[model samples]
Target: MIALEKQLKDELKRFEAKEESIETIFIGGGTPSTVDPILYQKIFKLLKPYIKTNAEITTEANPNSATKAWLQGMYDLGVNRVSFGVQSFDQDKLKALNRAHSPKQAKIAVLTAKEIGFKNLSLDLIYNYQGDTKALLKSDIEQAFELPINHISAYELTIESGTKFASTPKVRQEDDELAFFVAKEITKHGFKHYEISNFGSYESEHNKGYWKLKDYIGVGAGAVGFLKDTRYYPSTDIDAYIKNPLKIKEESLTTDELLTERLFLGLRSNIGVDKNILNKAMKKRADFLVEKEKLFKDNNLYKNTNYFISDELVLYILG
Candidate 1:
């Protein structure tokens, strides 16, 4: 924890961030609720000057570990938002996904946060597992809406390398329709489908910042930071990072790479691509899609009509 504080302090120094410049801060990428909130105090104290007064500060928590005391401590520290990893409300599905918490525990964790005065709460739901069905996903969505949360992120099950499912890849179902089903069910309840995987009555500022290609400072092991066209990375190994927090890597993105990123990110969300950023060939392809009703041009920006076909459309434009 001390090492992380030092590293964050160093990273901020390098960036020369101005006071009240950070509009949002998200503490995620791992199970953060397991850590004592006291450990977070120094980091918050150090970042207080740079964080805006109305900053949408968020921390990702596991339902099993985010106890009432933990939520209260973080709330006292000015963390006004919480994103819980609920995954699913079905016991069998939770077991299948190897989640540590039960449905009851997930409910308690979220309700506890709400009772503690958190106005902004979000939870994640995973769909398209081997046994996932419309009935099952519908129930999951229904249970989620029962909670006092404004946001939900429904993700399709994908086998990533190094995970147990990578060996038995069949655990992930290959169902395209379920994505639409889940999206429709979520938006039916009034939350906007602001991104491919996320829906919310109150949209996430952190998510929007990334899609709009805004620069952000990332800290801790394996965290990535962006400044203009360059990306910064510290050591991935926790021990190595703590030992020498200064060791870092840098990558400068090419113009073509940046363009590809913009196309994918912009199409995946309501943050449509700027027309001026497209070359003549890409513009021609985009216009063709607009003619086909696959995309709609909002004056100077071109937005996707269906996020599900976003990848294919971006690839078409790129070609």
Candidate 2:
């Protein structure tokens, strides 16, 4: 672990020297909270000189690993934000998803984080499970609000091609509908539906940078980085990352692809997308949507009727 910390520190210095600006740093993926707090402190100390004072430093933890002491250690080490992987509050659903923590444990984790003085806390919830009903989803949302968290990220269960669920039949359409329903319910609770799958009582400065297409540097296995107009990703292999942390494969996004990404990411916010970016056909479609009350138009931008339905609106517009 100490050796890995040293490698990470070295890589962060290299990136900072190579890139001029790095607005946010996200230390997530594969249970970062499992590492010792001292290692985190060491890493932070090394990178402190390069990062801005208001930089959003985020670390991810599984509910099972989010102990009170561990959370306190992370907070003491300069981690300002924490995101937990609490997929659901239903014990049956948790079991089906092969989660490690129970519903009670998940609640305890959130309470512990609050008790440990974490102001910017976020919880992850999964929706659209097979056999999941609206009542169950509502219960989940109610439980999320019960926590002192300001942010909630609700994700629709998707079956990827290589996953075990890919070969097995599961609820896809039902989950999509349930995701929408959950979004609406949460928005009514005073949380701002900021992104397609992210909700918060207040805006997330860290994520706002990403949605605004600002530069960020990610360090870890399979981590991605974006600076200026170029993007790159590290090898997914853990062994490769440990050996050669600087070996990043670069990829260039085309002009049209960049414009499409900007439009797509922008529409996810309540801020809406610029009307000038849309073609004549898209503008016509937007007019029809606005007339149907499915969309709201303010000046040169078009937004979803409910900011929570940004995903559905994006699909409708892009389709």
Candidate 3:
């Protein structure tokens, strides 16, 4: 761990020297909580000079791995935000997903994080489990709200092509109705539906940058980063990352692609996109959606209805 920390610090120094600015830093993937707190402190110290003071420093942790002492250490070291992988509150569903923590641990972690003076807490919830009923999803959202967290991220259970779930015969996907129900319940609880996959308090500076397509630096195996018009990603192999941290695959966006991506990401936010950017076809459809009560024009910006289904809204606007 000590050696890895040194390598990471060295990489950050090199990157900072080359890059002009950084808006956010996200420490995620492969159990960052498992790393020693001292290492975290060192990494933060090295990053202090390069990162903006208000820059959102975020780290992901599994509930089982986030010990109380570690949480405090992280707080003292300037980690203002912590996101836990609390997939579900149902023990059976947790087991089915091969999660390491129990439902109780999820609650405990939230309380503990709050006790440790970390106010910016985010919980991850997965909906559309193979057997998830609307009742179960509602219970999950209710449980999430019970936590003292200000942010909640709910994702649909997508069957990726290479995962174990894909190879094995599994039950059918949870119907769209259940997924929409979960999203609606979350908004009713006062959390802002900032993005399609993320919900939080109105002050989510870190994630807001990502949603707005701002610059961020991600450091870790298989981590991807977007800075200005360029995108880069590290190799997925751990050994490869440690050996040659500078070996990153890079891509530059074309002018047309950049404008399209900006519109795509901007439409996901509550702030909505600039009305002037809507093409002729999109303008006609947007008008129809407003009439259907699926979307509304507010201050010249088209915004989705708070109770409207997210996927339907997206399809209507973009598809």
Candidate 4:
């Protein structure tokens, strides 16, 4: 705890020096609920001054670990949002995913968070896993809506290298038809399909900050940050990061690379890309897509009609 606090304090020096205004803080990428919420008290205190008055502070938690006390502690510490890794409410699916919590635990966790005063809660659901049917996915979505959560992140299972599933890649149940069906089902319940993998009654500012390509400070081991066309990375080694949190490696992106990123990222989410950012060739392509009803023009921005084929559409426009 002491070492972590020291590292965070060291990282604060840069934000302090630049007089940067932080609008959001997401404590995620790992099981944060397992750690004592008191551990974050000092860190939040240190960051209080720089954070916006209405900052959307979020913490990711797991159903098994996020106890009522833990939820209350984080809420008291000004964490206005909590995203639970519920994945799915089906027991079979939970076992298949090797989730630590049960369906009952997930339900209880969300209810407890809501009762404890977290109005802006979100939960993630892993859909399109092996043997995931439309009925099973619908049941999961129905169970989530029964909870008090305002946002849902339903992601298709992907086999990443080094995971057990990677060895038996057939364990994945990703089909284009199933993925599209899941998106349509979620949106039918009034949640906006704001991003390809994200649906919400209310949009997530912290998540949107990423899709919008906003500059954010990333601290701690394995954290990455983006500023304009430059990307920043701290040491991935925990001991090295604790020893010198200020040591950062930088990567500068070329104009074409940055524009490509903007087009792709913007097209995949509700945040549409501005036509001004598109070149004559890109705009010409956009016009063709609009004529085909694959894209829509809203004022100056060109938005994808459906995020299901966002990748292929982006490639077509950019290529």
What is candidate 4's lDDT per residue for 1-319, written digit by digit as tens? Answer: 5655665676566445243288889998679999898888888877877887788999999999999999999999999999999999999889888889999999999999999988699999987788989899989989999988889999888888978788888778658898888888888989999998999988999889998888877877888877767898988887887777777898999998888888888889989889998889989999899999999999999999788788899999996
Candidate 2, residues 184-204, lDDT tens digits: the string is: 898899997788788998667
Candidate 2: pairs in clash: 128-175
lDDT for model 2, on a 0 to 1 scale? Answer: 0.77
How far out, in Å, is residue 148 in model 1? 0.8
> Which runs in model 3 stand beyond 4 Å of their true positions?
1-23, 169-174, 278-294, 298-300, 306-319
TM-score leader? 1
Per-candidate TM-score against the hidden true structure: 0.98, 0.86, 0.86, 0.95
lDDT of 1 at 68: 95
For residues 1-319, could you state the per-residue lDDT of candidate 1 as single tens digits?
A: 8888888888888888999999999998789899999999999999999999889999999999999999999999999999999999999999989999999999999999999999799999999899899999999999999999999999888888988889999898899999999999999999999899999999999989999888888988888888889899989899999998888899999999999999999999999999999999999999999999999999899999689999999999999
Candidate 1 vs. true structure, TM-score: 0.98
**How are the candidates ranked when ordered by TM-score, highest leading?**
1, 4, 2, 3
- In TM-score terms, candidate 4 sits at 0.95
- Candidate 3, position 238, lDDT: 84
RMSD of 3: 3.3
For candidate 3, lDDT tens digit of each residue in 1-319? 4444655565565455433255566778878888778877767766677766566777798999999988888888877789999989999999999899999998998899999887589989997778888788889989998889989888877777877788754644737677567778988998877777788774577777876777666666787777778887778788887777667788999866675675556666675666676777877887888898767788878776553354456556664
Clashing pairs in 1: none
**Better by TM-score, candidate 3 or 1:** 1
lDDT of 3: 0.76
Clashes of 2: 1
Which candidate do you rate higher for lDDT, 2 or 4?
A: 4
